[model samples]
Target: MSTAPSVTDRPRRGRRPAAQLVGIALAYFMVLLDTTVLAVAEPSIMISLHTGVAGVGWATTAYTTALASALVLGGGLADRLGAYPVFVVGVVGFGAASVACALSPALAYLLVFRALLGLFAAAIIPSSLALIAALYPDPGARGRAISAWAAISGAAMAAGPVVGGWLIAVDDWHAVFVINAPTALAVLVLCRTPITTTRRLRALSWLPHLGLAATLTTGTLAITRAGHRSWPEAVLFGLVALGLAYGTAAVDRTSSAPLVPASLRRDRAVWTAFAWGAAVNYALTTVLFSVPLLLHATATAAGATLLPMTLLVALNPPATGRLVAAHGPLRPIRMGFVAFPVGLALVAAGTAAHGRPLVLGLGLLLCGLGVSWTLPALVGFAVQHAAPDAAGSVGGILNATRQAGATVAAAVAGAVLTQDRGSGTAAVPFLIAAAVCALGLAGATTRHLSRTKEAPVADHVAEARHLGHMSRTSDGSSGELPGD
Candidate 1:
């Protein structure tokens, strides 16, 4: 087994450890919170703006598609320009967009502003991980830090409904967005710190990324429209989406500046991780988005109602981190997949049988367990293998895929949810989502998770190299960390 570095091998830092780490986590928390919070508010927004489910679906997809589109480019920009500038700009832009969303008078305006929110969020999500790598350069320190980071940020995915419920009860749909302004302000103030990371000009192919955005946007339009009895138009949009997706891939293959390097694209582990992350998000978002509409309860009531599930999601990551650390990610990851399918199935059964809250609550509890188990392990699995100076890009790729899953899941939920299906039950989407989560189980059982067996210490030196330290040598010299 590999051993921990000695005290002398550790960095001599001029750092505010708590402040810097907390600030970095806060940035991610803000970004993640937006994605889930909107779900609970969707029904209320549809009512307030006099819009249908399709309208709200468009708004939701606009935000996620833009985020998924821009994340790779955002990471590249962070590598080229510097993470600090990119992150700050994203935060400011996100704040402005959130306020704009609050002021939107119509669904059309809300959709545009939500897309703007996503564009800025792309900048925040990927770059934020690099900031964590910068703050905690030691391998063990970095891993633990990332665990906490994932815990906090992951909690947002489950906490959105809880938070949004209270906000909706107090005000209207506007409060759902308006609340972000102060949160964004807090992030800006808290995250102002100094660290340095290596910056090299990264060749970025803008066209492919733009094409990706277009593809998802069109696809979202198609899916959302299809369920609303607009098959002809949806078919037209679907054709355009396929064309755009193919074009983006073609360009990526040929472009000197591909969004993702061809090598990473070809790596089995990388693709597996990306796909699994997408599946995970799809299941979670599907549940979050659909449940509120199904419940027909007040926003606060719905949020409180989901606490059986969300509470576990909010609370379980620390233990998950420890479990993964001791047993490797495979066990927890498997546990998650098991819980996901069972939970989803129970929810489906409960809902189909006429809204049995007890069965539903058990299902929700398992859903939370699944998420809390799965996500941290996925993150640990990916970051443990990154190349030095590629932390932002690696983090970006993982998160972008996760967000992609989240976006499409929301669109799919909206697609199936356009009907006046009464309340407290929608068996079809939940069952489909369950099947998808089951696939995640089979998909993740590759050599990637099993690779820990090849090396007991599990890339300790590689991790240290990946997230470089700011430390004194024998002569008492030191340097700054990366991703400033």
Candidate 2:
């Protein structure tokens, strides 16, 4: 018998399933909105706080690094404690952290509170998805629900800059953080309804969690210091991170319940999806980070420029879901990979041409379309390929990789921009992003094409079996023949 509980088994005492989904989506929206809003408000923050570019960059870096480091542990906690409870706690904590961040008197305090925000955010992400999965038991409905979730996130990302810029213009950067309080409170109220809970899994080993945290934190710090610090120091950080990563793998191997279970670690599809997530975000963050500095634009202008891109990102995923349902994920994913580099190249050209508005606009549009095409499919594939009971873990790992990519992007972009705060320097990061997109494209084409070729053969076999046809062998046993 299947161990998974039926959806109908639970009593419907609280909110309806649709209400639950909205509540979860709102919580997720708050997290994504905060990230994008900060991107727009970052320049204002530097001015208000009397900090350097690198210091302002650390605000984002610290939060994302903490988030990436704690994701696996957060997912494990969700699976053990139940998604509803974990999600409620995360929402309350995130709200408190936002209040603390708004009240921060210094840059150091802001960074600390931002890191706290990330720690709680890690709890919200995976559990939100797990809760959605629990709420919608039907596979097809679940897919649609996930598409909606992605759409909500895309909308929040698009709105963040617009909202943040307006707040900064009207009041101050702190208002951006202050706004999160009400939204989080609304989520808390909506989520007060009871939901079904999952069976608690065995507690995960702590060593692997520590190793993963050390590896990501040190690795991000190493990248952040590149071009700003001595090579020897950067190398030491890198080496230490590498050693920690290796140790994490060793611990994973020895542990009964590893942080990243072998089933997921060994799955090619899962890792490929993770890589795609990382690469796409790396490119996206690089663009979001460098464009405002290059144009010497106001927070409002910066947000407006990015608005088209993020809006497209929001609108494209529902269409992408339709495409995935009809043609499978490979085509759209490959198309996205190809378009991403082209878009970056365009943006680079535009930036080099003294921030030409038309060129930059076109480039951002393409980048948005590219991400919209790929991200839903990538996430869907990751979830589909995960072990049945390990959805939370897989969600955590996927998000962790994406955050790590963002962390690297912010660090590298900060380093590049620090050296030359001119519009010309913006092209450098865009070119680098294009190269990363090309790498993702190459991997997608090579692996997905091989899978595509084999698909027809598998289809033919399935058709023959459906037809109740089999070939007789010399030993008188009937079996499926080659190309049957």
Candidate 3:
């Protein structure tokens, strides 16, 4: 029995001690930058393409759905093919698609190109993290690298909107897409090492998986029939998510080289962190999309121009990183839930008082800061808790859940707004956000509570050692470094 314990409790493989952190950082920057850049360019795209709201929205939808579909596969592909190969392919493919998107003259062409871009972008997150783990074997170094990754990602997201806006103002929607090509090309140029390739590619074809993904994407797209929020449609989408999720689970279980590693799904901590992140994302997307609209509508209704209302939409990404990094992620996540409702309340009050952009902007900033904290922390936690080989799978799952939540929120909130126009109606989404956040907050609190009673005696010894090390390291002239 003791020998059995040792066999089963063996430590998993960790990241290698040496990998180029700079390459990984650059790749992630491109991926995250792409994630948010399109939002600011939407108005310009619509006008230039002569597209309706539905037409323009497909740009986002196609990207997201394609990303979701590719993500699971991307992880498995990484294991078989190699992280570097997958990442390079993703970058080159994404860059090509970006150029296509930029050059496209029609809305249909743009959608197609954007979907193509999504396919490549899907690999960047999981593959990058997997590479990080494969490269950095030491837990402390790996953790620091991941933190640095999170910091870069957060900073990119913060910067994307303004950069996107600038691109739109200076040129056209094409500029947004054009910008990606150079960045991606640069990433490829800098990382010249041949990435690993998967044996899975030779072992089996991807047709079945691709078919399953197609079905899910088709069904998800069908839900955008904004006026068709009937029971039948809801049931249809539910069945689609259910069917695809089931097929994925089944195939993954049976396949020798499954897209999501079987070991990854079994971890309680990973699942919990992923769920929390997804729920928060669902709430945040609703808020991010809604607040700007609310502010613009209010301003327009009050006979004011909406040019200044752009400030509210602009508030979020700028300071998200600094705030989240300053405090440990959990506290910020907790604060985010609290701050969300408070921000909404301020917006509600401000709208009622007068359509003041300043108050609205301030409110949006608070909400943004709150999300910044939660997101990176969630990413870090998910990656850390997952098995080493499964980093890509876990990251994909985490991102997939987050995007799924966002997709659902967009549909549901859009429906609500379509049906009603009242202060109370606006409050409904915020209330739902607050409730979802409360659940996440409760989960966080429970984690803390559970940890409290599991205190190890060695923790005291470790703390004393750490303190001594820190004391020695610190010459009374500088603060102790993290993990000291």
Candidate lDDT values, in order: 0.70, 0.72, 0.56
TM-score-wise, the better of 2 and 3 is 2
Task: Write the number of the candidate with greater TM-score, choosing between 1 and 2.
Answer: 2
Q: Global lDDT for candidate 1? A: 0.70
**TM-score of model number 3:** 0.71
For model 3, how does the per-residue alpha-carbon lDDT over 1-484 read when each residue is reduced to its tens digit? 0011111212223342223566666766676667565655655665678864445456666776676666666655655566677888888888888889889989888878877877787777557766655555566776676556545544554566567667766686688788888888777666665533222332333643575466556555555553345667766766776777777677667765455567775777778777776676666666544553444332112212222222322233224333334443345556666766666565555544445667766665666555644664555455545776566455556666666566555555555554553666666666666677777778877855345332233433222211111100000100112111
Give stretches of model 2 more than 4 Å off.
1-20, 133-153, 383-392, 447-484
In model 3, the runs with Cα more than 4 Å from the true position are 1-24, 130-153, 193-223, 226-234, 258-269, 291-333, 344-354, 379-393, 416-431, 442-484
Tens digits of per-residue lDDT for model 2, 183-286: 99889777778666563554656777667767877876777667586678789999999998898899888886676766777778778878988898888888
Instruction: Give per-residue lDDT, candidate 2, residue 24.
Output: 84
Runs with alpha carbons beyond 4 Å of true place in candidate 1: 1-17, 135-155, 192-196, 353-355, 382-393, 422-425, 445-484
Which one is best on TM-score?
2
Residue pairs in candidate 2 whose N, alpha carbon or C atoms collide under 3 angstroms: none
The whole-model C-alpha lDDT of candidate 2 against the native structure comes to 0.72
